[model samples]
Target: MKDRLAASYWLHESQYAAMSSSAVTERRRAAMERFESEGFPTVRHEDWKYTSLKKILKAEYALSSPFSEADESETLEFKDIKRFLVNDIDCYRVVFINGRYSSWLSETTHQGFDVCTLGSAWKKYADQVEPHFGRLTEGLGATVQLNTALAWDGLYVNVPAGVTLDKPIQALYFTTGEQPVFTQTRSLIVLGDGAKAEIIERHQSLTEAETWTNAVDEVFMGANAHMHWVKLQHDSPSAALTQHSVIEQKRDSHATVHTISTDGKFLRNNLDFKLVEPGAEARMFGLSLADGQQLVDHHTRVDHLAPHCVSRENYKGIFDGQSNGVFNGQIHVHLDAQKTLAFQENDNLILSEKASIDTKPQLEIFADDVKCSHGCTVGQLDEDALFYLRARGIQRKEAQALLMLAFAHDAVADIQHPSLQAKLHRLIGKKLGVDMG
Candidate 1:
């Protein structure tokens, strides 16, 4: 055995690979090889300066494999959103419990859409799936690769050419444990030419368990295709989550991602897009609310490799109760990629002096004929905005919450899903001390 493969003995290689039929085995081997050279990432690493995993290492949490949860109520929530068809209609649904897929609560009845267990798809499309399945996680860093190496049950959704899904496909990942447990989920979504669809990825816990989920999702948009993604993450105080997403946009296609994070002990997310062809368009929008010592981080990168492409990004968050947050956006424009237009912005509000934020918005351009700009702002509640609202007879706490929500409305209103928008609004309202339900 090689040196990298040596430490892998601590992990269950085969059982972990059993979840998705994709080229997980090969990716696992490659990741193990990489892990051999670079053990675990430390705070010394630039991308992970604020997030410390040493505490987790000492927590003694079990590395969750294919263990069954007999205590779970066997209930899954896909229609957790009002307008979602995944709960009521013929929309496809995939449910994963504690990092494993439960077929009993999932279905694949959508016409013209091929939905299969990640394991099954791997067996048939090993060659195609192997190459891209682990690419994003590998580029993401340590925890993500660890997720790819240990993922057991995930889903693969493929929408064929010109086929528009009737309802937003839903993926719900839930947990049912008390101790500190770990879960890594991988999903691959491919939208063929001219296909249009909405995907809702929801994360919640059954028992508010002290769990950690390192999830990676990759989307490939073919020519002229359009794809919308909504991610909702809310869990107990003991839960920690790290999610990474990579999107590839082909000629004349559009890809958009909206991520909402309100509850978690520690959470970090990485989102990127590669414009490989002309006319490609990409947008990323997110909102986060952190309270009670929670920490949330979001990092994004967009590479303009071709000319005549466009990209936009916006992220906002509210930090309260000594919680912390971070946002880093790096946009790259390559030479010869003329006519490229890209804009990135990050704005944050701190509800308390104890709350903190680290914001870095960057731009690296090698093209002379391109237009690219990036900026970030870290500030407290707009006193003027609050006073203005209160001048109109609004209460103090209520006025502050309203001002913060108004600051966040830009990103939330951009969401195209009404049901999802309402859910997120309620969550934001709750964070602002309003009755969400």
Candidate 2:
């Protein structure tokens, strides 16, 4: 796989030598070299100790390029795409099919602020794109480096200073092809001082063909800016995803991210937040439902670099049918970051005796006056509560499903969008095999 990736890099570099600027090209080369040197993370790597990539590495996958113009993406219509979208919402849409942009299914704009594809932004606004494209994701990990070397097109949103978007933006990526494919997607989001925006992102596979996606998102929040980002992962059983999100918050900026994963063969999420200036705050919430031998892993980190910063993380999971779950969360408070407040929690419920989970919540405090705490819990459903529900004329399965819904409620309670919340409820119900209405 590494050799194939190396060959593909050279092929792409020669094919589109003029696609990017000299500096950007150099950065890509550097990233590729780093990836070649480090390769993929193994079990020996502390961060990836609980997860294994043997299933993905053994299979031969065709690497997808954004410059490919041979895909049959135009055949899709609103009906085929509506099932994956959030209904009853007025928002700007950007759709990509097999890593290629689909104009017919996308509604982009540059009316006041720019909300369009990163490919167009690279061509039209190189000055702005150059400064913020790969700024936040340098030396993060080998997978990130691989993405930087191969990424072509993804969503780009820039809200100007003092401006607030009236509606949210939805970015959707669908995978459909005849053969197994591996795609790399890069996205850049920038919010100026006092600007506010909301974004919803999803990746889906339209077919049963095997597909693998490596996505990286770099978000920058200026002073007093606020951002709400949500990621929904409900792909086919043959699909796999490894996603990384890096967020940099400036003075007094606030950023919140929600990750909801219900289906997929294998899923791993890496979320990192850096509070670079004083009074910045970051919040993260995640929920995962794994069944039928699926594997879901989440790793999160928060760095308090300045004084008066706050961060909170809450993650929950339910494992059944021999599925496995892993969670590793860390909160680091620097020496000079006094008056910091941080909290972390991970809770999991095991339905089947065969199902299992590994959770680790860590905290490192260098500041003496900081208030920080971390904890985790692994348990089963309350027998008393289940018996009470069963005694009231409810079936065992329905009663268990109701208890699971209540267990997963707090993870999504912070979402402000009513329609998205409703859609998420429906998805959860479908995953649990019961009606949540």
| Top-TM-score structure, candidate number | 2
Q: Candidate 2 on 97-206: residue-level lDDT in tens?
A: 77777788999989889889887777587788788877888868899999888878899999999989988999998887777888888898999999999999999988
lDDT tens digits by residue: candidate 1, 264-300: 7888888989899999999999888898888888989
What lDDT does model 2 reach?
A: 0.88
Every candidate's lDDT? 0.76, 0.88
TM-score of 2: 0.97
TM-score of each: 0.90, 0.97
Residue 127 Cα positional deviation in candidate 2, in Å, after optimal superposition: 1.4
Specify the poorest-scoring 10-residue window by lDDT in model 1: 80-89
